[model samples]
Target: MNRKNKIPKFIFYMIALWTIFSTAHAEEIMPKAFVYTEVQNSVPFDQIPWKSRNPIISSQPGFISKTWLSGSGNNSVGGIYSFDSIENAKKYVTKFFPNAVKKQGVAHTSRIFDAVIVEKASRDIGSAHFGGKISTKPGAFVYTEIQVNLPFKNVPWQQRNPIIKKIPGLLSKTWLSGVNNTVGGFYAFDTLENAKQFAIEVFPKTAAKMNAALYTRIFDARLVEHASRGMDSPFFQ
Candidate 1:
């Protein structure tokens, strides 16, 4: 099917799966925390030690998701990867990339940080393509992408729901899961400035609290447009 047709079909499948699995009472899953190291003055796009390791690692059982390599734009050698569960994710790291444990005369380094999936939502319709008539103005709508690790297995929906409501400038929020149940969420904001400000001011405070409960790493970015074009979509409303 074409991309347009796939959207609705994908939505339907996701909803059906959600209805079936919502009641399973599974534990909250978290991804392994790891940093991909790149040399500060390395050659551009040249093959390196870990260059081919990503595909091999991502194909493993517990692998949640992996980002594609950026060729020219943002030529950083590092990217994020999520896993189904912390234990499995860590096992994979130790088994496959033992050298990552120590920088040990290596040109690059990898460090694993503690992480947790705070939320997961499915059947999300892209806000940019929702077909609803909404004004797009400066500071009209903003998208906040947050990655934080928090403990508290089976986080009380009561606690999370209230927190979502309290976030300033949150027009809407949605949770999502990708391959192997990588957990994450997205928040819509009234303005780009509002989204940026929240990430700068409120997110760190929240992360600090979350880290106290569970070791956590965070990545916060603002979406320029709301077309839902990225992999992170389909789960964020």
Candidate 2:
């Protein structure tokens, strides 16, 4: 081949290889998918046999980690889970998880989020799974989601950080941005009372100000530590 032609061909091959390498690297470091689920008015955490259920959960496709949640004031039980991909997370929540919880005879709520998109914002607030494992003193958790008409980019997550940090007993938080402008977070606090207070009184007022529908739940983080640790939960570590 001519020298000129050979040089151009080599450059093209190098560019192609560089592109492939960059794409692969991005995938490797991409944030994981997350799933949250809760059963209202269900059995107590101790009665759920969550520890024994770890084996089955661990064997699921793309399962990464899980944090078991027990309602603070009511008999609700739930979990926050991480998965390798959004497809797998959605499948687990819609296809696999529901059937497993049907025996409770109570309605459960589930939602999926693209963890990659909110990694920066979440980490700024000490999200454990996102390398911001600052406050490990969590004994309770508060989960909240508010439906809004705006897009995820307009959600003001950073602006709210200062206010959230001031809330009594707060430990860490992982922000969630879901489909159709539904945004929320999974939070950790020092006590169930504090978590419940935030979920019920503080956050709801914010939601009301936005005129958005809100979903909130408070959980006993201490009770489910064993079950969460068994599933390699980041919060436990």
Candidate 3:
């Protein structure tokens, strides 16, 4: 073929290849978001009927990216579950686990919020490290919790912000109101160990200053999946 003919064909081929490559890359790095739902109730810890329902719910169709359960160390309790898709997460709650919900008699619940898994680190070296079903990727996952008392609704946001910011491994923070008859915030950490240490050392003092109690939990990324949509993009860079 002549040079002029060949040149045009080359450009067309290049365009086609570029288009395919771009599409494939987009699919590979497609942003992933997590749905976080907190369930709280007054049911007795040992008597709760999660054994029959939780396993089935967890094994449901879609994708239960990650999940974790933490006890309140007393009667009142709460737990967080993360799902790959909002639809799947909602289905598990509204459809699959109807019986479980009724059994617990969930007093109050929060709307499903989206979270993104931004920076993942290793968990091997942390004090809170307790190996589990999840893999060990050094700092891949972190968990955090704070317990505060009620009747202090008028506290300054400025004072509360610093206290949460000081906690080690805190990736993000958000406050939930009107459940468990108390007001408190949840924090995302970089490692379980860091989260545990912070709860033991720093959280108490902060809670005292705010006139609140403190409760905390931590997990590895393999065991914990988070999706942050709308609030703040985990992939800001």
Name the candidate that leads on lDDT: 2
Index of the highest-TM-score prediction: 2
Tens digit of per-residue lDDT, candidate 3, span 1-237: 599999989999999999999986444333222333445644453454544545555576554333333332333333444445556656765665555556656644433433222212112121111111122233322333345434324535455566565556665544433222344444555676776676667667766876665655443432222221111222111
For model 2, what is the error of residue 74's alpha carbon versus the real structure, in angstroms, after optimal superposition? 1.5
Off by over 4 Å in 1: 1-54, 68-79, 98-157, 165-196, 207-237
TM-scores of the candidates are 0.37, 0.83, 0.40
Please provide, for model 2 over 195-224, each residue's C-alpha lDDT reduced to its tens digit, 9 standing for 90 to 100: 878887899899999988988888888888
- List per-prediction Cα lDDT, in the order shown: 0.40, 0.82, 0.44
Q: Can you write out model 1's per-residue Cα lDDT over 115-223, one digit (the tens) per residue?
A: 3333331112222222112233223222222243323244344556666666666555434332243233444456546665665676557556645321111222222
Count the clashes in each prediction: 5, 0, 19
Output the TM-score of candidate 1. Answer: 0.37
Deviation in Å, model 3, residue 26 alpha carbon: 21
Tell me which residue pairs clash in candidate 1.
33-112, 33-113, 121-175, 121-176, 139-191
Q: Which ten residues in a row have the lowest lDDT in candidate 3?
A: 121-130
